[model samples]
Target: MTSPENAPASRGPVVWYAALAVVMLLGVVAVVAARSSSNTVSNKVATAQTSKVKTGSSSKALPQLMDGKADAAIGQIIPAVSGKTLDGDAITIGPDGTSKVVVFVAHWCPHCQAEVPKIVGHLKDSPMPVGVKLLTVSTNVVKERGNYPPKAWLDRVGWTAPVMADSTDNAAATAYGLTSFPYFVVADAEGKVVTRVTGEISMDTFDQLVKAAETGKAPS
Candidate 1:
């Protein structure tokens, strides 16, 4: 028979063992929960990144030119224009002994948004000819507009052309006499303006403009 004092002592070890088991079980549960939560967060992050990549992937549709016409500025010397790129590199435009195709785009223009992907796709599929430098001028950036920030929009479209970020006053656009979005200006190796297209143009028109710029003549 156990004494009254022995009863408490006998129960003490059992209680301690049960308490320890409970604590261990809780610890294991907590660790498992934490790992599960971590995995969930990681999966969400991966899914978001994949979605962004898929959304920005290149399209296969060909582009078409519209309302294209030769400019009066044709045969005139292109202005010595300069601006910074999205990566903060200084870019100067003019006669650099190479034909240049300058594409002026606005972030807020729906037409520009539609045209950009097509241009990128066409350029990727069929690269520009040698001695032809393709450039883009990101202008008219407005926060409350169609695409919001211009830099992100360009990145989203996977624009790989040399970009010249226009100033707050749109100095580059003004220098080129831009009256509309998605404008195209082609200049010869000698910096002479060959032609200007006011709207989106097809790849054939793009090639024609480049050829015209190189030969110092407007596209027929």
Candidate 2:
């Protein structure tokens, strides 16, 4: 038969190889697109987390201080009612039963940066005085400066003290008449204001304040 004499020959090897190459190219393009989308999503998540740390507020209580409330002392007694840490952890609500609470910090303030490492080291390693507690408050709102103390900064500085975001309204800053950075405010076990020091207080000075509060002896 005529058909038996010659059927159209199949595609040549080169043609088939070319088709296979095209298919492989398409697969590579699809994979690249998928990876790009995944990278975008990951980038968005990281940016949001870091941004929140820069501008988030813990709560709204310090605003009352602006209204000129002297009973503010009553409010500071409860730490949870005050502020929160960068990692969304509880800051010092008040002094523990055995220790007074001392806050040493500033938000944009430069000196606070220097004081952090030593203070955290002492607070972590040394035993608390009988009437000592440890707490910290931001003197400035993180604001647009992105200057707020983010968890990243705290971790980088190795500050372990329970820190509060006083940035919402400068409540802590106003409470102690903070005129500068690196301020220290010590509250006795009873949550009474005992000592207020401006500028950097040496580790020795910190000890004196705590020991004096506990033993009622002034710095030697």
Candidate 3:
């Protein structure tokens, strides 16, 4: 039998113990809920960013070429080479004494993946000059996208054109006065420059230029 005063004091401890247990359980639940909410928010943010890059807005793509005035000086010199092919030998730009090199490359460019194939097809079977040679060069801009292909990967891609390499700084790209990739230029036999084409072109353009070279006509 306990005294009346002592009884209340003993009951107080039991009450306090139950209250503490309830508080601890509530704390644990709150922590778990907060972590779950944070993870959900993070996942949503990641998905949105990826979507943004894929669905580029109207402002980000290459501007469509029209009858606007284009600076012809953009493509003045041939894009020089800084790397060899997959084999240890030096990658040759042209065999013909007067070579007409068509460089298919990009500036940290994903579009190059598509444009490169078309350029390759044209150079393989297009009507080039009898004494002219053609080539494709990849600017080392792929490192920016974190998807730079191995040198060998660029070589095997259905290209009959001899491929060359550029420095990460794109030194060869600068010589042609091009600030972008998939650039084109025609060099005369004596290494005199003909014309510099700055945008993506079709096989017809290559043929047109070859005809232009033969006729001494500047490419339109």
What lDDT is reached at residue 4 by model 1? 86
TM-score of each: 0.67, 0.56, 0.55
**In terms of TM-score, which candidate is stronger, 2 or 3?**
2
lDDT of 1 by residue, 49-165 (tens): 000011112212112223454346766766766656766776776667888888989888988998889988887878888888899888877655655567777789998997877
Task: Judge candidate 2 against the unseen true structure and give its global Cα lDDT, from 0 to 1.
Answer: 0.56
List candidate 1 segments past 4 Å from native.
1-70
Q: Assess candidate 3 and give its TM-score to the true structure.
A: 0.55
Residue range 25-95, candidate 3, lDDT tens digits: 99999999999998875422111101001111221222222235564443233333334543333554431
How does model 1 score by TM-score?
0.67
RMSD of each: 16.3, 15.2, 15.7
**lDDT score of model 1?**
0.73
Off by over 4 Å in 2: 1-81, 95-98, 123-125, 143-148, 216-220
Please report, as a residue range, the 10-residue window in candidate 1 with the lowest summed lDDT: 47-56
lDDT of each: 0.73, 0.56, 0.53
Model 2: pairs clashing at backbone N, Cα or C within 3 Å: 79-93, 99-132, 99-133, 100-131, 100-132, 100-133
Q: For residue 132, give model 1's deviation from the true position in Å.
A: 0.4
Model 2 root mean square deviation, Cα atoms: 15.2
